[model samples]
Target: MEEFEFITQSADETSILAKRLSEKLTRRDVVTLEGDLGAGKTTFTKALAAGLGIKRNVNSPTFTIIKEYTDGRLPLYHMDVYRLEDADEDLGFDEYFHGEGVSVIEWAHLIEDQLPNERLDIKINYINDSTRKIIITPYGSHYVDLCKELRDESISH
Candidate 1:
Protein backbone atom coordinates (compact mmCIF):
# COMPACT_ATOMS: atom_id res chain seq x y z
CA MET A 1 0.00 0.00 0.00
CA GLU A 2 1.15 3.50 -0.77
CA GLU A 3 0.01 7.10 -0.93
CA PHE A 4 0.10 9.50 -3.83
CA GLU A 5 -0.71 13.17 -3.93
CA PHE A 6 -1.72 15.43 -6.79
CA ILE A 7 -2.50 19.09 -6.96
CA THR A 8 -5.16 20.06 -9.46
CA GLN A 9 -5.33 23.68 -10.43
CA SER A 10 -8.90 23.66 -11.66
CA ALA A 11 -12.06 21.60 -11.95
CA ASP A 12 -11.04 20.47 -15.42
CA GLU A 13 -7.69 19.35 -14.12
CA THR A 14 -9.37 17.33 -11.43
CA SER A 15 -11.67 15.77 -14.01
CA ILE A 16 -8.73 14.86 -16.20
CA LEU A 17 -6.96 13.18 -13.31
CA ALA A 18 -10.09 11.22 -12.45
CA LYS A 19 -10.54 10.20 -16.07
CA ARG A 20 -7.01 8.85 -16.19
CA LEU A 21 -7.56 6.88 -13.01
CA SER A 22 -10.82 5.48 -14.34
CA GLU A 23 -9.16 4.13 -17.45
CA LYS A 24 -7.12 1.64 -15.41
CA LEU A 25 -10.03 0.48 -13.31
CA THR A 26 -11.56 -2.95 -13.69
CA ARG A 27 -14.71 -4.62 -12.50
CA ARG A 28 -15.06 -5.00 -8.75
CA ASP A 29 -12.66 -2.19 -8.06
CA VAL A 30 -13.75 0.01 -5.17
CA VAL A 31 -12.89 3.67 -4.80
CA THR A 32 -13.88 5.62 -1.72
CA LEU A 33 -14.08 9.41 -1.79
CA GLU A 34 -13.75 11.42 1.40
CA GLY A 35 -14.44 15.10 1.36
CA ASP A 36 -16.72 17.74 2.75
CA LEU A 37 -19.73 19.21 1.00
CA GLY A 38 -18.82 20.92 -2.29
CA ALA A 39 -15.41 19.26 -2.20
CA GLY A 40 -15.74 17.84 -5.75
CA LYS A 41 -16.61 14.29 -4.85
CA THR A 42 -19.51 14.12 -7.31
CA THR A 43 -17.50 16.04 -9.86
CA PHE A 44 -14.80 13.39 -9.81
CA THR A 45 -17.38 10.67 -10.07
CA LYS A 46 -18.89 12.32 -13.14
CA ALA A 47 -15.51 12.44 -14.79
CA LEU A 48 -14.91 8.81 -13.88
CA ALA A 49 -18.23 7.80 -15.41
CA ALA A 50 -17.36 9.60 -18.58
CA GLY A 51 -14.03 7.81 -18.75
CA LEU A 52 -15.86 4.53 -18.31
CA GLY A 53 -17.81 5.34 -21.51
CA ILE A 54 -21.02 6.40 -19.86
CA LYS A 55 -22.96 8.86 -21.95
CA ARG A 56 -25.73 9.70 -19.54
CA ASN A 57 -25.60 12.28 -16.82
CA VAL A 58 -23.94 11.42 -13.53
CA ASN A 59 -25.23 12.83 -10.29
CA SER A 60 -24.79 12.29 -6.60
CA PRO A 61 -27.13 9.68 -5.17
CA THR A 62 -27.63 11.49 -1.94
CA PHE A 63 -31.26 10.62 -1.45
CA THR A 64 -31.38 7.46 -3.53
CA ILE A 65 -28.38 6.10 -1.64
CA ILE A 66 -27.17 4.15 -4.69
CA LYS A 67 -27.38 4.62 -8.43
CA GLU A 68 -26.39 2.07 -11.03
CA TYR A 69 -25.20 2.99 -14.49
CA THR A 70 -24.69 0.01 -16.78
CA ASP A 71 -24.12 1.82 -20.04
CA GLY A 72 -20.40 2.04 -19.44
CA ARG A 73 -17.70 -0.49 -20.28
CA LEU A 74 -18.33 -1.89 -16.85
CA PRO A 75 -21.29 -1.08 -14.65
CA LEU A 76 -20.79 1.86 -12.36
CA TYR A 77 -22.33 1.60 -8.92
CA HIS A 78 -22.30 5.02 -7.39
CA MET A 79 -23.18 5.13 -3.72
CA ASP A 80 -23.65 7.97 -1.30
CA VAL A 81 -23.82 6.90 2.31
CA TYR A 82 -24.15 10.34 3.83
CA ARG A 83 -27.57 9.55 5.20
CA LEU A 84 -26.68 6.14 6.58
CA GLU A 85 -24.98 7.45 9.68
CA ASP A 86 -28.00 6.91 11.88
CA ALA A 87 -29.54 3.95 10.11
CA ASP A 88 -29.03 0.25 10.68
CA GLU A 89 -29.73 -1.72 7.57
CA ASP A 90 -27.86 -4.07 5.35
CA LEU A 91 -27.66 -2.36 1.99
CA GLY A 92 -26.17 -5.48 0.42
CA PHE A 93 -23.15 -3.44 -0.51
CA ASP A 94 -21.14 -6.60 -1.00
CA GLU A 95 -23.08 -7.33 -4.16
CA TYR A 96 -21.91 -4.07 -5.66
CA PHE A 97 -18.38 -4.32 -4.27
CA HIS A 98 -17.87 -7.79 -5.74
CA GLY A 99 -20.08 -7.39 -8.74
CA GLU A 100 -19.02 -6.97 -12.37
CA GLY A 101 -18.63 -3.24 -12.08
CA VAL A 102 -16.63 -0.52 -10.49
CA SER A 103 -17.94 0.96 -7.25
CA VAL A 104 -17.39 4.49 -6.06
CA ILE A 105 -18.61 5.42 -2.61
CA GLU A 106 -19.03 8.94 -1.32
CA TRP A 107 -19.04 9.60 2.42
CA ALA A 108 -17.61 6.13 2.81
CA HIS A 109 -16.62 6.74 6.41
CA LEU A 110 -20.26 6.34 7.32
CA ILE A 111 -20.15 2.71 6.27
CA GLU A 112 -16.50 1.98 6.92
CA ASP A 113 -17.16 -1.38 8.46
CA GLN A 114 -18.76 -2.70 5.29
CA LEU A 115 -15.97 -1.79 2.93
CA PRO A 116 -13.71 -4.48 1.57
CA ASN A 117 -10.13 -4.94 2.73
CA GLU A 118 -8.78 -3.86 -0.66
CA ARG A 119 -9.79 -0.48 -1.97
CA LEU A 120 -8.53 2.95 -2.83
CA ASP A 121 -9.29 5.83 -0.50
CA ILE A 122 -9.13 9.35 -1.85
CA LYS A 123 -9.32 12.45 0.30
CA ILE A 124 -9.98 15.72 -1.41
CA ASN A 125 -8.88 18.95 0.22
CA TYR A 126 -10.03 22.26 -1.08
CA ILE A 127 -7.10 24.56 -1.63
CA ASN A 128 -9.08 27.40 -3.16
CA ASP A 129 -12.25 28.08 -5.10
CA SER A 130 -11.13 25.93 -8.03
CA THR A 131 -7.99 24.18 -6.88
CA ARG A 132 -7.84 20.90 -4.98
CA LYS A 133 -5.32 18.72 -3.25
CA ILE A 134 -6.05 15.07 -3.87
CA ILE A 135 -4.53 12.52 -1.55
CA ILE A 136 -4.87 8.94 -2.68
CA THR A 137 -4.08 5.94 -0.49
CA PRO A 138 -3.92 2.44 -1.88
CA TYR A 139 -4.94 -0.34 0.48
CA GLY A 140 -3.86 -3.46 -1.44
CA SER A 141 -1.41 -4.72 -4.04
CA HIS A 142 -3.80 -4.10 -6.90
CA TYR A 143 -4.37 -0.50 -5.91
CA VAL A 144 -0.67 -0.10 -5.21
CA ASP A 145 -0.01 -0.98 -8.81
CA LEU A 146 -2.78 1.39 -9.87
CA CYS A 147 -1.11 4.19 -7.97
CA LYS A 148 2.24 3.37 -9.54
CA GLU A 149 0.69 3.50 -12.98
CA LEU A 150 -1.03 6.79 -12.18
CA ARG A 151 2.24 8.23 -10.94
CA ASP A 152 4.00 7.15 -14.09
CA GLU A 153 1.24 8.62 -16.18
CA SER A 154 1.49 11.89 -14.31
CA ILE A 155 5.23 12.00 -14.74
CA SER A 156 4.93 11.36 -18.45
CA HIS A 157 2.55 14.28 -18.83
Candidate 2:
Protein backbone atom coordinates (compact mmCIF):
# COMPACT_ATOMS: atom_id res chain seq x y z
CA MET A 1 0.00 0.00 0.00
CA GLU A 2 3.01 2.28 -0.14
CA GLU A 3 2.73 5.04 -2.73
CA PHE A 4 5.26 7.20 -4.56
CA GLU A 5 4.53 10.32 -6.55
CA PHE A 6 6.52 11.77 -9.41
CA ILE A 7 5.82 14.86 -11.49
CA THR A 8 6.90 15.14 -15.09
CA GLN A 9 6.94 18.38 -17.04
CA SER A 10 6.86 16.73 -20.44
CA ALA A 11 6.58 13.43 -22.28
CA ASP A 12 10.35 13.18 -22.35
CA GLU A 13 10.50 13.40 -18.58
CA THR A 14 7.82 10.79 -18.23
CA SER A 15 9.70 8.49 -20.55
CA ILE A 16 12.85 8.95 -18.52
CA LEU A 17 11.02 7.95 -15.38
CA ALA A 18 9.47 4.92 -17.05
CA LYS A 19 12.83 3.83 -18.38
CA ARG A 20 14.32 4.10 -14.96
CA LEU A 21 11.55 1.92 -13.57
CA SER A 22 12.04 -0.64 -16.30
CA GLU A 23 15.61 -1.13 -15.22
CA LYS A 24 14.36 -2.39 -11.88
CA LEU A 25 11.82 -4.79 -13.33
CA THR A 26 12.31 -8.55 -13.57
CA ARG A 27 10.54 -11.63 -14.82
CA ARG A 28 6.99 -12.17 -13.53
CA ASP A 29 6.73 -8.51 -12.59
CA VAL A 30 3.34 -6.95 -13.21
CA VAL A 31 2.88 -3.23 -13.79
CA THR A 32 -0.66 -1.94 -14.12
CA LEU A 33 -1.33 1.45 -15.66
CA GLU A 34 -4.43 3.56 -15.00
CA GLY A 35 -5.16 6.93 -16.57
CA ASP A 36 -7.47 8.88 -18.80
CA LEU A 37 -6.98 9.19 -22.50
CA GLY A 38 -3.81 10.94 -23.70
CA ALA A 39 -2.25 10.49 -20.27
CA GLY A 40 0.81 8.90 -21.94
CA LYS A 41 0.39 5.26 -20.95
CA THR A 42 1.65 4.03 -24.28
CA THR A 43 4.49 6.53 -24.22
CA PHE A 44 5.61 5.18 -20.88
CA THR A 45 5.42 1.60 -22.13
CA LYS A 46 7.54 2.48 -25.13
CA ALA A 47 10.20 3.93 -22.90
CA LEU A 48 10.03 0.92 -20.61
CA ALA A 49 10.58 -1.32 -23.60
CA ALA A 50 13.55 0.76 -24.59
CA GLY A 51 15.00 0.43 -21.12
CA LEU A 52 14.58 -3.33 -21.32
CA GLY A 53 16.62 -3.24 -24.53
CA ILE A 54 13.67 -3.96 -26.77
CA LYS A 55 14.41 -2.59 -30.21
CA ARG A 56 10.93 -3.02 -31.63
CA ASN A 57 8.36 -0.27 -31.52
CA VAL A 58 6.07 -0.55 -28.52
CA ASN A 59 2.53 0.67 -28.97
CA SER A 60 -0.84 0.15 -27.34
CA PRO A 61 -2.33 -3.24 -28.04
CA THR A 62 -5.81 -1.77 -28.01
CA PHE A 63 -7.22 -4.08 -30.62
CA THR A 64 -5.00 -7.05 -30.12
CA ILE A 65 -5.46 -6.98 -26.37
CA ILE A 66 -1.93 -8.25 -25.87
CA LYS A 67 1.40 -7.92 -27.59
CA GLU A 68 4.56 -9.83 -26.77
CA TYR A 69 8.14 -8.76 -27.38
CA THR A 70 10.82 -11.32 -26.54
CA ASP A 71 13.91 -9.81 -28.07
CA GLY A 72 14.74 -7.75 -25.03
CA ARG A 73 16.73 -8.32 -21.86
CA LEU A 74 13.53 -9.84 -20.62
CA PRO A 75 10.35 -10.50 -22.53
CA LEU A 76 7.76 -7.71 -22.46
CA TYR A 77 4.06 -8.42 -22.44
CA HIS A 78 2.07 -5.30 -23.19
CA MET A 79 -1.66 -5.57 -22.64
CA ASP A 80 -4.49 -3.09 -23.11
CA VAL A 81 -7.69 -4.42 -21.61
CA TYR A 82 -9.77 -1.31 -22.34
CA ARG A 83 -11.62 -3.04 -25.17
CA LEU A 84 -12.53 -6.09 -23.13
CA GLU A 85 -16.11 -5.47 -22.22
CA ASP A 86 -16.45 -8.97 -20.80
CA ALA A 87 -13.63 -9.37 -18.34
CA ASP A 88 -14.78 -12.84 -17.45
CA GLU A 89 -13.23 -14.44 -20.45
CA ASP A 90 -10.18 -16.53 -19.66
CA LEU A 91 -7.38 -15.40 -21.92
CA GLY A 92 -4.70 -17.46 -20.22
CA PHE A 93 -3.66 -14.36 -18.27
CA ASP A 94 -1.87 -16.49 -15.73
CA GLU A 95 0.50 -17.68 -18.41
CA TYR A 96 1.62 -14.12 -18.95
CA PHE A 97 1.50 -13.09 -15.33
CA HIS A 98 3.66 -16.05 -14.42
CA GLY A 99 5.67 -16.06 -17.58
CA GLU A 100 9.36 -15.37 -17.81
CA GLY A 101 8.84 -11.69 -18.58
CA VAL A 102 7.40 -8.44 -17.38
CA SER A 103 3.74 -7.70 -17.94
CA VAL A 104 2.50 -4.14 -18.35
CA ILE A 105 -1.26 -3.86 -18.32
CA GLU A 106 -3.29 -0.84 -19.39
CA TRP A 107 -6.77 -0.31 -17.98
CA ALA A 108 -6.10 -3.09 -15.50
CA HIS A 109 -9.16 -2.19 -13.51
CA LEU A 110 -11.21 -3.86 -16.17
CA ILE A 111 -9.66 -7.17 -15.11
CA GLU A 112 -9.24 -6.47 -11.46
CA ASP A 113 -10.31 -9.91 -10.30
CA GLN A 114 -7.85 -11.60 -12.60
CA LEU A 115 -4.87 -9.61 -11.51
CA PRO A 116 -2.35 -11.08 -9.09
CA ASN A 117 -2.47 -10.06 -5.44
CA GLU A 118 1.04 -8.64 -5.66
CA ARG A 119 1.71 -6.11 -8.37
CA LEU A 120 2.63 -2.51 -9.02
CA ASP A 121 -0.21 -0.11 -9.84
CA ILE A 122 0.53 3.17 -11.53
CA LYS A 123 -1.93 6.02 -11.95
CA ILE A 124 -1.13 8.85 -14.28
CA ASN A 125 -3.04 12.13 -14.13
CA TYR A 126 -2.87 15.09 -16.41
CA ILE A 127 -1.93 18.20 -14.42
CA ASN A 128 -2.06 20.42 -17.51
CA ASP A 129 -0.87 20.52 -21.06
CA SER A 130 2.57 18.87 -21.20
CA THR A 131 2.55 17.95 -17.53
CA ARG A 132 1.62 14.70 -15.72
CA LYS A 133 1.48 13.43 -12.17
CA ILE A 134 2.43 9.77 -11.81
CA ILE A 135 1.31 8.00 -8.67
CA ILE A 136 2.86 4.60 -8.05
CA THR A 137 1.40 2.15 -5.54
CA PRO A 138 3.43 -0.91 -4.64
CA TYR A 139 1.57 -3.99 -3.39
CA GLY A 140 4.47 -6.27 -2.49
CA SER A 141 7.89 -6.19 -0.92
CA HIS A 142 9.67 -6.46 -4.25
CA TYR A 143 7.74 -3.58 -5.70
CA VAL A 144 8.27 -1.55 -2.56
CA ASP A 145 12.00 -2.04 -2.87
CA LEU A 146 11.84 -1.28 -6.57
CA CYS A 147 10.12 2.04 -5.92
CA LYS A 148 12.67 2.91 -3.30
CA GLU A 149 15.46 2.27 -5.77
CA LEU A 150 13.71 4.29 -8.41
CA ARG A 151 13.27 7.17 -6.00
CA ASP A 152 16.92 6.99 -4.96
CA GLU A 153 18.01 7.00 -8.58
CA SER A 154 15.78 9.96 -9.36
CA ILE A 155 17.23 11.92 -6.45
CA SER A 156 20.81 11.23 -7.48
CA HIS A 157 20.16 12.19 -11.10
Candidate 3:
Protein backbone atom coordinates (compact mmCIF):
# COMPACT_ATOMS: atom_id res chain seq x y z
CA MET A 1 0.00 0.00 0.00
CA GLU A 2 1.41 3.35 -1.06
CA GLU A 3 0.03 6.72 -0.03
CA PHE A 4 0.08 10.38 -1.11
CA GLU A 5 -1.42 13.40 0.59
CA PHE A 6 -2.63 16.70 -0.82
CA ILE A 7 -4.13 19.74 0.83
CA THR A 8 -6.29 21.99 -1.31
CA GLN A 9 -7.02 25.52 -0.19
CA SER A 10 -10.25 25.74 -2.13
CA ALA A 11 -12.72 23.76 -4.18
CA ASP A 12 -11.12 25.04 -7.36
CA GLU A 13 -7.78 23.74 -6.24
CA THR A 14 -9.35 20.36 -5.54
CA SER A 15 -10.85 20.37 -9.01
CA ILE A 16 -7.48 21.15 -10.54
CA LEU A 17 -5.88 18.32 -8.62
CA ALA A 18 -8.61 15.94 -9.72
CA LYS A 19 -8.19 17.04 -13.33
CA ARG A 20 -4.50 16.27 -13.13
CA LEU A 21 -5.41 12.85 -11.79
CA SER A 22 -8.14 12.22 -14.35
CA GLU A 23 -5.69 12.78 -17.19
CA LYS A 24 -3.81 9.71 -16.02
CA LEU A 25 -6.78 7.38 -15.72
CA THR A 26 -7.34 4.53 -18.18
CA ARG A 27 -9.88 1.88 -18.93
CA ARG A 28 -10.92 -0.58 -16.22
CA ASP A 29 -9.60 1.65 -13.47
CA VAL A 30 -11.48 1.76 -10.16
CA VAL A 31 -11.23 4.77 -7.87
CA THR A 32 -13.01 4.95 -4.53
CA LEU A 33 -14.04 8.10 -2.72
CA GLU A 34 -14.50 8.03 1.05
CA GLY A 35 -15.45 11.03 3.10
CA ASP A 36 -18.14 12.75 5.08
CA LEU A 37 -21.05 14.64 3.61
CA GLY A 38 -20.06 17.86 1.82
CA ALA A 39 -16.44 16.73 1.77
CA GLY A 40 -16.12 17.39 -1.99
CA LYS A 41 -16.50 13.85 -3.34
CA THR A 42 -18.97 14.91 -6.02
CA THR A 43 -16.95 18.03 -6.69
CA PHE A 44 -13.90 15.89 -7.39
CA THR A 45 -15.97 13.65 -9.64
CA LYS A 46 -17.19 16.67 -11.58
CA ALA A 47 -13.61 17.69 -12.21
CA LEU A 48 -12.73 14.21 -13.27
CA ALA A 49 -15.63 14.24 -15.69
CA ALA A 50 -14.30 17.41 -17.28
CA GLY A 51 -10.86 15.90 -17.67
CA LEU A 52 -12.39 12.86 -19.29
CA GLY A 53 -14.07 15.24 -21.78
CA ILE A 54 -17.53 14.55 -20.48
CA LYS A 55 -19.86 17.45 -21.32
CA ARG A 56 -22.84 16.37 -19.22
CA ASN A 57 -23.57 17.54 -15.75
CA VAL A 58 -22.15 15.43 -12.95
CA ASN A 59 -24.13 15.35 -9.77
CA SER A 60 -24.33 13.22 -6.68
CA PRO A 61 -26.11 9.99 -7.46
CA THR A 62 -27.53 9.61 -4.00
CA PHE A 63 -30.91 8.60 -5.34
CA THR A 64 -29.94 6.95 -8.61
CA ILE A 65 -27.21 4.88 -6.98
CA ILE A 66 -25.26 4.83 -10.26
CA LYS A 67 -24.94 7.06 -13.28
CA GLU A 68 -23.13 6.38 -16.53
CA TYR A 69 -21.53 9.06 -18.69
CA THR A 70 -20.32 7.86 -22.08
CA ASP A 71 -19.43 11.08 -23.84
CA GLY A 72 -15.96 11.21 -22.32
CA ARG A 73 -12.75 9.83 -23.79
CA LEU A 74 -13.78 6.66 -22.08
CA PRO A 75 -16.99 5.75 -20.24
CA LEU A 76 -17.35 7.15 -16.74
CA TYR A 77 -19.24 5.03 -14.22
CA HIS A 78 -20.10 7.11 -11.24
CA MET A 79 -21.65 5.26 -8.33
CA ASP A 80 -22.87 6.46 -4.99
CA VAL A 81 -23.35 3.53 -2.62
CA TYR A 82 -24.15 5.66 0.36
CA ARG A 83 -27.62 4.17 0.63
CA LEU A 84 -26.44 0.61 0.43
CA GLU A 85 -25.96 -1.26 3.65
CA ASP A 86 -24.95 -4.67 2.32
CA ALA A 87 -22.89 -6.13 -0.53
CA ASP A 88 -25.60 -8.62 -1.44
CA GLU A 89 -27.30 -6.19 -3.77
CA ASP A 90 -26.54 -7.26 -7.32
CA LEU A 91 -25.63 -4.01 -9.04
CA GLY A 92 -23.56 -5.83 -11.65
CA PHE A 93 -20.27 -4.23 -10.69
CA ASP A 94 -18.29 -6.59 -12.89
CA GLU A 95 -19.40 -4.88 -16.09
CA TYR A 96 -18.23 -1.55 -14.77
CA PHE A 97 -14.94 -2.74 -13.27
CA HIS A 98 -13.95 -4.67 -16.40
CA GLY A 99 -15.69 -2.39 -18.85
CA GLU A 100 -14.21 0.11 -21.33
CA GLY A 101 -14.37 2.97 -18.85
CA VAL A 102 -13.25 4.00 -15.39
CA SER A 103 -15.38 3.60 -12.26
CA VAL A 104 -15.62 6.14 -9.48
CA ILE A 105 -17.32 4.76 -6.38
CA GLU A 106 -18.40 6.97 -3.52
CA TRP A 107 -18.82 5.61 0.03
CA ALA A 108 -16.85 2.63 -1.15
CA HIS A 109 -16.17 1.26 2.27
CA LEU A 110 -19.72 0.04 2.40
CA ILE A 111 -18.97 -2.36 -0.43
CA GLU A 112 -15.45 -3.31 0.47
CA ASP A 113 -15.94 -6.99 -0.25
CA GLN A 114 -16.95 -6.27 -3.83
CA LEU A 115 -14.06 -4.08 -4.87
CA PRO A 116 -11.19 -5.33 -6.98
CA ASN A 117 -7.80 -6.14 -5.51
CA GLU A 118 -6.11 -3.34 -7.37
CA ARG A 119 -7.55 0.17 -7.20
CA LEU A 120 -7.14 3.65 -5.78
CA ASP A 121 -8.76 4.73 -2.52
CA ILE A 122 -9.17 8.40 -1.74
CA LYS A 123 -10.37 9.92 1.55
CA ILE A 124 -11.25 13.57 1.93
CA ASN A 125 -11.06 15.37 5.27
CA TYR A 126 -12.72 18.70 5.70
CA ILE A 127 -10.45 21.32 7.22
CA ASN A 128 -12.60 24.42 6.95
CA ASP A 129 -15.30 25.96 4.79
CA SER A 130 -13.03 25.96 1.76
CA THR A 131 -10.08 23.70 2.62
CA ARG A 132 -9.82 19.95 2.35
CA LYS A 133 -7.14 17.36 3.05
CA ILE A 134 -7.11 14.46 0.67
CA ILE A 135 -5.34 11.21 1.35
CA ILE A 136 -4.82 8.85 -1.55
CA THR A 137 -3.81 5.22 -1.20
CA PRO A 138 -2.81 2.91 -4.02
CA TYR A 139 -3.64 -0.75 -3.64
CA GLY A 140 -1.59 -1.97 -6.60
CA SER A 141 1.31 -1.09 -8.86
CA HIS A 142 -0.72 0.78 -11.46
CA TYR A 143 -2.12 3.21 -8.94
CA VAL A 144 1.25 3.44 -7.23
CA ASP A 145 2.74 4.63 -10.49
CA LEU A 146 -0.03 7.15 -10.86
CA CYS A 147 0.68 8.62 -7.44
CA LYS A 148 4.40 8.65 -8.15
CA GLU A 149 3.87 10.53 -11.36
CA LEU A 150 1.66 13.07 -9.64
CA ARG A 151 4.09 13.46 -6.78
CA ASP A 152 6.99 14.01 -9.16
CA GLU A 153 5.01 16.54 -11.15
CA SER A 154 4.07 18.44 -8.02
CA ILE A 155 7.68 18.45 -6.86
CA SER A 156 8.93 19.66 -10.23
CA HIS A 157 6.51 22.57 -10.10
User: Would you estimate the TM-scores of all the predictions?
Assistant: 0.97, 0.98, 0.97
Per-residue lDDT tens digits for candidate 1, residues 28-92, read 99999999899999999999999999998999999999999999999999999998856457889
Clashing pairs in 1: none
Please provide, for model 2 over 72-148, each residue's C-alpha lDDT reduced to its tens digit, 9 standing for 90 to 100.
99999999999997999999899999999999999999999999999999999999989999999999999999999
> Quick one: best TM-score, which candidate?
2
lDDT of 3 at 58: 97
Give the total clashing residue pairs for model 2: 0
The RMSD of every model to the true structure, in order and in angstroms, is 1.0, 0.7, 0.9
C-alpha lDDT values of all predictions: 0.95, 0.96, 0.93
- Identify the runs in model 3 with alpha carbons over 4 angstroms from their true place: none
Q: List, residue by residue over 54-153, the lDDT tens digit for candidate 3.
A: 9999999998889999999989999999898666787898789999999999999888888999999999999999999999999989999999998887
Q: What is candidate 2's local distance difference test score?
A: 0.96
Query: What's the distance in Å from true for residue 78, model 2?
Result: 0.3
For candidate 1, the lDDT comes to 0.95
In candidate 3, residue 33 scores what lDDT?
A: 100
Top model number, lDDT: 2
Return the candidate ranking by lDDT, descending. Answer: 2, 1, 3
